[model samples]
Target: MSKKMGLGKGLQALIPSYEDENKKTLRNITVADIKPNPKQPRQEMDKQKLQELADSIKEHGVVQPIVVREVPDGGYQLIAGERRWRACQLVNMDTIPAVVTEYTNIQAAEVALIENLQRENLNPLEEAVAYQSLINEFGLTQEELSKRVGKSRSYVANMLRLLALPDDVLALLSSGQISNGHARALLALDTDEKKIVAANEIIKKQLSVRETEKLVKELLQNKENRKKKNERAPEMEDLKDQLQGVFGTKVQIKTNSKGTGKLEIEFYNDDDLSRILEILLDDNSHVSRETN
Candidate 1:
């Protein structure tokens, strides 16, 4: 591991010792010569945000030096601060201040992922993808990944689960239509259909996390009710069918564990309701006459 370096200490830990002390000092490097890290996990940058950064760079100059490593052919490969490099380009700066660092490809990826995450720049889906890459490519366990990223193990695990979401839900997450909390709530639903339905509802209603949780719970409860209804005895189903035939409408019988239950009959109009009432009243009158 990288010595459990925290946010501020990360850059110092990644900086390499230069044989010539002057080489370690920050210096202006040609913006055109610095190439972006191919392994960089962040796929998108907000152009407006970059423009704001560029405006700042134009006004104050590049305050923080970007980190880069010397490439084999010539120039350099950016290890960190890609946003600043881009902003410098936007401001038409020929050269930007940078620190030269030496790191393996995996180390560079780790540093880039850490920087983006610490800044809360990457969306949930992007964060999850980045974490998965490190786990798959570098064989880092969830615990190790958590420690390296300065996040809880459960947080890492939860973030990884976002990747398993349906593409539609992932799209919502990527596009900022839904939040991480909303996505997490959607995970409670068992099927993709239900999840997509819930996701759409969330976006349409602009639901809060708690509201989304409540909605998922209702959906799961209805699902469980249907499953339980399907598991009922054949005799109960037959009874329901017989009742429906007598009532000339749909009938549902729901029972509890103790055998307590209610019978529900569906009637579409007043005439239909009157017909059902007549049957019940006639049956009651017949029973009363027999008792007399």
Candidate 2:
């Protein structure tokens, strides 16, 4: 077994020699020359974020050189510092700061995955993907991956399972279109179509994570009922719309299983209440309405 290095030794491993404090090696590395590892688990990168990193690099040149290993194929392979390389490209720089060495495929992959995990800024999806890569490509067990990243085995396992979600759902997750809680809730549905539909409803209704979970449970129980029920529920929604249109304000209606429901009419203050009462009275309906 290769003994793990301490922090100082690890830093030295990446930056082998520290000469003059002011004199750093900054030369002869093109963005195109640095190839991303095929085994890299993080398949998605946020473009907007890359632009932001690039902007920062423009203001301050890359403070850190990416660690790389020269491939037998006559080019360099990225071991760590993909974000830095991306930032450099944003500035359209011909050369970047990098530390080049020779490493086996396993060593390069392990280094890259470990480096990204140590950096705290990675989003949950990125963390999950990296964890999956370690398991799939490097033959690391969940317990081993957990130890390497300072996470529990369950944490590692749960995150890895997130990748099994549908592509659209994963895209929503990566883009921050939905919360982890929301994604987890949607994952309960068995079909991709169900998951997608639930995802849409969660976004459209601004549903809370708990609410989404309950909604999923209810839908799963009534999966057959859902098909017979109106997909859009135009009739039910139209009632709220018409009420709001007539009231010239927001209206809320909630229904129960028996088709009995309550309507809550909203008002800003005494003035608004008075207007509503006046309209009700002027309508001259046969049924009398009570008010406080």
Candidate 3:
């Protein structure tokens, strides 16, 4: 038998007794009477796509009933099919076929979130925000949340990480200047300044995701090299200060783990050099050094 197409885990499994035909919960409700879901996962809707949906609804009418919950004030708060509802409104639809169901705030929010995820309509940021909301308010673990949204655990975790990105980088992502892959590459950097700079480089160079990853790798390698070459040991600093104190002149010391180093003694003139030499000879300090 050919099965009907549906959402994550089947909407009926997610919600018990959803639109049981025998119950006769379906009705034509005034469009103005229904209110938007406060927990609508989709933050932005493309106007062109919405207009297209409106045209389709106009021609074929709503193929499925929208779900809503009647509030205490006798008004309806939409639980699912927000796009259809909005499309109907665009066409100045007076009423829509809705299944009035009894659901608590949590159930309504979950249904709305799953609907958006299954439809794959939300941008990365919007998806992250929705995931965060569910985890924060409902205390859902990533594993649990992934199953509900029909995504792998890694996908859900990666989406949550996007929330940690600085606002400007996120803006770059949200505005379509960079893709989620680009954003993931930025996450490898250790600081916000680096992330922002890399994001700008991505836009200016029009770098692809692979190129961005390579850029990030090179930046990190350079940083590591700098750290190794310029790293000043604490004992080296102490020796430099002591040498400066004894010679009455500035002293610089640099060394690596191999105990190879250089000692630079500043001198004002020949007199200063003679004084430094006298001190060094008196101490009989022996040293060997290598240039990095």
Candidate 4:
């Protein structure tokens, strides 16, 4: 991991926290008029958690306002504090207190990503998807993204790799059934079938992340061993070549682990068979020695 750069400079500072929102000059705007940010990286909000916050707001009221930008036509668009905005709505508030600002499209997206990251609101899968979306939509490199979000480059890169997982594994991750560590360890497996099998075992056995890593390592080692055993030796092919030359016919050799098997020589006609027999009898091959 790169050295911890405090999430406090440049674009990182653009994202407003609840405390920061409290400091800005607040404006009370109709909650219904304020629209959700199109660039918002958060896909969904937890209903139960939203209700808990709503309960807190009902008693104490909205202590910190949400931040918004003026729309070209009219009204405002949310830049951050979506959860606070939603909670106010749960309480049937007509207008929400907000701090108005101006932001470009890319700036809005950057703030949205950083805001969620700062609050730890996104799950592992959502965080990864958001990273990919920002990179795709705005053409930002992982290193650039890391600096923008104040994360290490490897942290951004590793998060992006979680997308390569199978749909089943992704579902497990999205639903909070498995952790990011478990999902990452499973990627070492090459086949979806093996990954799914491992995932099931993870859930069933209640395996920890370290246990999952060990399991996947063993599976990969076994796969490599099987591949080595299935490969044929070079000398086997050379022996088949010698047999074919001696008989002047198409020849094949098959053997078991015990080195006991059959040698096949193909002949189309009686003349061909006679020709092959003549060569075998004249040569110092095992068949001729046995006959003598």
Candidate 5:
């Protein structure tokens, strides 16, 4: 499905149904009475952005009501809209508009994550961890999670893979020193050392995603070449030995997959060179005589 359409599906799933008047009623709840959701996906709020939001709340007031659920202590636990709740607190408003709902812990977590996702509030690492928590805590599969979050399965899978990155690399990603594309490209490498090196180069050189990908490809290709060189066949080794014996010197043979190769016979001095040349001339004369 198109991302736009899937996002709508996800939003609908996250939004609570308020068909009944009891569920739909907006109540003025005391700001101090509401506790933040422990499962809220967002870890850090942008202070500058929050200050701007608080200023806007002062001028315009909250346009949308925060969603909350009642706790045993007769207080409300914020299910969604923590940003608005925070803004209300910033302005020291006594009571804020809230929609009371009944939700289990899992439902509350889902609601909070989806709300932040819809608003694009959580960083990539935070988003991945939130998704992982739901999977581990609630046993949601990637497919199920994608449906719940209104994203493609690949998108969810790729996000989860980011967690495998080293802490330093993840820090780079979190701090915006490198983009997600750069991180993903680094995953092509098998070792953390290589990944860290590549990441540093990317930041220092200001490399683009495509450039990083190319660099990774070249590194992998060079690695494979070394592996192939180290794994030469016994037959090739035997051939090299025979050539060395025939030439009275060292010889080397290099071949590629297409049955194409190069052969080099080494000589240490003018005498050695003349000996090799005479050997080649004798072979040529023998071939010519055989053909005649």
Candidate 6:
């Protein structure tokens, strides 16, 4: 299914019990009689969202029953209907209608996740967590996930990487304090302190994502310069490494801390310089070195 049709996309158009001639009556099944699927991709929901769903359920009856798998323990394991289950509970419904199916753990998880994604129901965090779960729980690669969900591998990879963010940033994203683009800007920062500072600057300055990207680049460049200055002649040192690689000769760099540095491009005379120059400026490429 296309990711555009994520879990909630055509859910209303799905054959609801009301529309099915052979649909089971709205009957109450014991809450204890239902079991959570161990293979369920979505393990948690935001309390605020849950409450909101519950309020909606209180107003309109559960339009759909949950899908479940019968367990030997007399209860039914949830298959692909968590949203309906949660909403029903919010309205204090003791028993909910369920259609029990027999499926392996892997099959159940795949179905559940795909159904949710197709309906466009999972939020970004939930989607990431679900994708991560599908990988960790099922041993699927980003490429495989992309194939399954009809998304590009890069899209799957990037979404999965969102989980690498710190908790504070994740909270900001979940709470709508920052947009995904802003979070992407923070990801450019190499350290938590720097990222947090950038995040603060973003909120304070009301910078757009593009502006944040530019600001982060400038800050990173400044950081690199500070690091180089602390190490003295870092540009020459790096140049030595590069030139050595290019000319196959031991290159040396000499510098004095009095705001002066020298690039000792040691070479075996004329032929070495040719190779060095070629490596330095390959295919009209301009390699410029700067201290700051």
For each candidate, what TM-score against the reference? 0.79, 0.61, 0.76, 0.74, 0.83, 0.62
Q: Candidate 2: deviation at residue 39, Å? A: 3.2
Residues 1-292, candidate 2, lDDT per residue (tens digit)?
Answer: 3345332224345344446455354446878888887766466677898899899889998888888777777878877888888788778988888877555666666666667656655666877887777678778898877765567788778888788789988888887788878888887889999998889898899999999999999988786556535553666677678767767788887765445668898999999999877866775633332333
lDDT of each residue in 21-122, candidate 5, tens digit only: 545557899999999888888888889999899999999998988899999988999989998999989999899988787777777787788888888888
- Which ranges in model 1 have alpha carbons more than 4 Å from their true place? 1-13, 16-25, 238-292
lDDT of each: 0.84, 0.74, 0.84, 0.82, 0.83, 0.70
* lDDT by residue (tens digit), candidate 4, 1-292: 2233334364335734435644564679998988998777777688999999999988998987787888888989898899899998899988888877666676677777788887888888889998898899889999888887878899999999999999999989988889999999999999999999999999999999999999999999888765654665465676777777777789988776454789899999999999888877874665321111
TM-score of 5: 0.83
Ranking by TM-score: 5, 1, 3, 4, 6, 2
Tens-place lDDT per residue, model 6, 105-224, is 655676677777776666666678878888887899888777666678888888887787788777777766777788877787898878878887888898999999999999998887
Which stretches of candidate 6 lie above 4 Å from their native place? 1-28, 37-60, 227-292
Candidate 6 residue-wise lDDT at 176: 63
* Model 1 alpha-carbon miss at residue 230, Å: 0.8
Output the TM-score of candidate 3. Answer: 0.76
For model 2, the stretches where C-alpha displacement exceeds 4 angstroms are: 5-32, 101-103, 118-123, 220-292
Off by over 4 Å in 3: 1-8, 15-21, 232-292
Whole-model lDDT, candidate 1? 0.84
Tell me the tens digit of each residue's lDDT in model 1 across 1-292.
3343453355455555434675564778899999999878888899999999999999999988888888899999998899999999888899998877666666777888887876778999999999999999999999988877778899999999998789999999999999999999999888898899999999899899999999999888777776766676676777777777777899998897444889899999999999989988774533211111
Each candidate's clash count: 0, 0, 0, 0, 0, 16
Candidate with maximal TM-score: 5
Measured over all alpha carbons after superposition, the RMSD of each candidate to the real structure, in angstroms, is 6.6, 13.7, 6.0, 8.2, 5.6, 12.0
Q: Which window of 10 residues has the lowest lDDT sum in candidate 1? A: 283-292
The count of residue-pair clashes in candidate 3 stands at 0
The residue-level lDDT of candidate 6 at 82 comes to 83
lDDT of 3 by residue, 1-292 (tens): 2232233575655443544776677889999999999899887888999999999999999898899989998889999999899999999999999888777666777778777766777788988998899899989999978876778999999999998899999998888899999999999999999999999999999999999999999999888766765665554566666677788998877665455778777899998899888888885664433334
